[model samples]
Target: MPNNRSAAEISECIRCGTCCKKGGPSLHHEDTVLIEKGLILSKYLFTIREGEMSYDNVTGQLIPASSDIIKIKGRKGSLTCVFFNEPESACTIYDKRPLECRILECWDTREIERVYAKTRLTRKHLVSTIAGLWDLIDDHQARCSYEKINRLLKMLGGDNKDDALKEILEMIQYDTQIREMTVQKGGLDPDIVDFLFGRPIKETIGMYGFKLKKQGDAYRLITIPTGQNL
Candidate 1:
């Protein structure tokens, strides 16, 4: 890749919205001004929980990532950036966009990757008023962490397999119930539940070699090969 480009070279971008089409930019601590000004609402953000797997742009590899990252939520069922205006091929909040969006250059990724490496804005920084919610998150996470769930699966074998599976299912259900109840009692938006509790039970459990199959209002566990890497 070219190390440098002139203004004319950078002006090659046609505003086709292809980059934003891929996904929304993750917010940095510097972008808190936009959030505080209501340009970026809490409802518009979601958390990427610690230990969740994601593609690292800097490393160009899929890695078990850490950090409770706050990212702009994408449109439902789509990867497109929430601020992207499809008809105009422009950003809806271009004037007050996240730092990543402002510095991104399709021609050279050095700037964006540098910003990406910095500490991200977390829920604690954005919603400090709701310290209780953070406490609830910690409680739920300790009880139903991926490490605990994975360990439970690893212990499965022999005649105790059925009993172990039942325990895993119950743990998942219990975790789901806590998340739902948190939203109901804490007055948090239902849309942000996944952010608080990490991904859905099925997806999180899938990281530990289990898949959920829905059957007539019930879920069945199916063990798939995961290399037991977790």
Candidate 2:
């Protein structure tokens, strides 16, 4: 027998923990209540901003995100969801999981596919009403948008490469300074910075084959050699 088991025919969850280990689930509109109710915390989340390059597990490619993808943070140094209890092969938040987690079925994936990209929760959705902080986040997005970074990366290979590099360096410096300021001066939780501003440009720039070299208090952006640290 071919063991013709269709996804629809699979009715029970095996509690194998495959999905939780893969990575954290992205927040959806319905999941906002979890955050509002304090079941989930901002410190445990991060954002993939619009136009940022990220791996699409479904498409199996690195693609530019079309909109904000706010997701739970992974365990430090690993992609596994922070709330996953690996020893027990279970999710700590299983009963209060995000919409993506509730809908996900490793064998089928149809339910998750249909709702994954719809009604995603973003920074504005969560913090737009807050005084001062929203202004800072808005300013940060304008000054350090991935859209602008992509354009600058393209310019690096063009006639005005020097000017482009200078601008890129300035953006990187600003991004780093602001993050430090928020933690040191604004009394913000360091863990929540990723959720507020997306990942630091100095680190995320690596996706475009660039890395930073520090010389005293100043920083320089340089291209990585082929087949080297990506």
Candidate topping TM-score: 2
Off by over 4 Å in 2: 1-11
Give lDDT per model, in order.
0.76, 0.88
Model 1, span 1-230: residue lDDT tens: 23255555665566767679888888888999998898888777777766666657678876665776778888988989888988888899999989988888877788888788697887668665766877877877777766676567876865677887888888888878877797788777887786677667666666656788889988788877768632
Best by lDDT: 2
Model 2 shows how many backbone clashes? 0
Candidate 2: residue 184 Cα off by (Å): 1.2
Q: Using alpha carbons, what is the TM-score of model 2?
A: 0.93
TM, every model: 0.80, 0.93
